[model samples]
Target: MARYAILVRGINVGTAKRVAMADLRAVLEESGFSAVRTHLNSGNAVGTGNDGLDPAEAGARVEEALAARTGVSARTLVLTAGQLRTIAAGLPYAAEMAAVEKAGSRMMAHVLFADPDPALLAEHDLTAIDPGNVQLGERVVYQWCPNGLLESPDVSGWITKNLHVEVTTRNWNTIAKLADLL
Candidate 1:
């Protein structure tokens, strides 16, 4: 069996896209995943699935099941336990970045579900903004907002709004919890 981390975008935020964590776990279990567990209320889950199924394929199955069983439609990204570990390990100066935490939102992982356009670099160069504040991984953009997500000089929204990539940002705290879950 392969353990996978499922990241769902835009759920249980505000009044729309509401998906209860309990329902999410049920949905994944019904979708043929076992050992299903959810972290937090923001649509993050981990489950054990067939080793032969690829992460993307497993994600698609869960996405369909969530909509069919739970009636919640959202972009979902799945990463293997190993891939998740790699992502968590790739954060440059992770401890220092995490230390800047304020309101539990200072550090974040901008998980990219699609390939970002090359032109994105021209719009915002995160590296130039702060020393060791941001590190762009193949699947994620690790950012440390020294002044908090809101006052970090536009470090928060630029990547999430990238026109070419469907990116979802998760707090470093959430990432750490998810790592432990897997």
Candidate 2:
């Protein structure tokens, strides 16, 4: 069996999507995922499943269950434990550690659902994303928002808008916690 981290977007933010972590865990467990658990109330979940469980399929199943059982529809992304560890490990070793240390919650990662188009990625550059602030990795993009999330380049939003891709973001602290949960 392999462990997977499920990220549900746009939930528990403001008064709109308010999905309880316990409810999400219950739904995931009922959907056939084993060892299901939730980290924060912010839509992060971890669970164990068969080796053949597809991430996209798991995401869809979680979405369907959330909609049918909880009445909240949101985008979900799944990553293998190894993938999550890789993303966590990819940090701290890079030359951008200074920004990371200083940014705190500003150090954000845009976890993507799939490999975006190369041409689309190269066609435009986000001006607000500093050189050291942007580090693209396998199915993920890490950026430091020194002035906070509001002042950042909105890399995830830009990708979804231009590349037509779906993405969810997490702060460095949240990423570390999710990695630990896996």
Candidate 3:
């Protein structure tokens, strides 16, 4: 069996895409995943699935099941337990970023396309901006918004405009918790 971490984008932010965590767990279990568990209110789940299924395949199954059960389309990012751990461990500027967050800055991690083109990172030249710092990793991008998500400079906007890559951002805190769940 392989453990996978699933991230659903824009599912529980407001009342619009509400999906109860319990329901999500039930959905995954019913879809043949075992030891399903969810963390926090956001659609993050970690579970063991049948052997030979990769993260992409597992994610597709979960997304289909979720749409069928909840009647809402959701974009999901699924990573293996090893991938999740690597992402958490590879976070840069831990103390400095934490201090910024403690001082009211927001730390967000953008999960890039499942197979983000390496050239895209170079094409856009994601860099540190005023009142915020952006760093691109293997399959994740870290941005510390000193102001806030709404107030900070449009990191996602520029990425979408220039690179045209689909991404979903989650707070570093949520990511850390997800890592722990795995």
Best by TM-score: 2
Give candidate 1 misplaced runs (Cα > 4 Å). Answer: 98-104, 115-132, 153-157, 160-163
After best superposition, candidate 2 residue 44: deviation in angstroms?
Answer: 0.4
Each prediction's RMSD to truth: 2.8, 2.1, 2.3
The residue-by-residue lDDT of candidate 2 on 23-69, one tens digit each, is 99888887668998887788988899989888898889989999999
TM-score versus the correct structure, for each prediction: 0.84, 0.90, 0.88
Residue-by-residue lDDT tens digits, candidate 3, 1-182: 88878888889887888998988998788777899888888888888876677677767777899999988788877888887888788787576665663632377777875655668766656784533378777677777776677877777667766667777777877788888887
Please provide, for model 1 over 1-182, each residue's C-alpha lDDT reduced to its tens digit, 9 standing for 90 to 100: 89988998899989999988888998888777899888888989899998876777767887898899778898888888987898787877656754553534677788877656777766766576556777788788787776777765554366656535677789878888889999
* Runs off by more than 4 Å, candidate 2: 92-102, 126-129
Q: Rank the candidates by lDDT, best first.
A: 2, 1, 3
Worst 10 residues of 2 by lDDT: 92-101
Range of the 10 consecutive residues with the lowest summed lDDT in candidate 1: 95-104
Model 2 scores what on Cα lDDT? 0.82
User: How much is 73 displaced in model 3, in angstroms?
Assistant: 0.7
lDDT of 2 at 153: 73
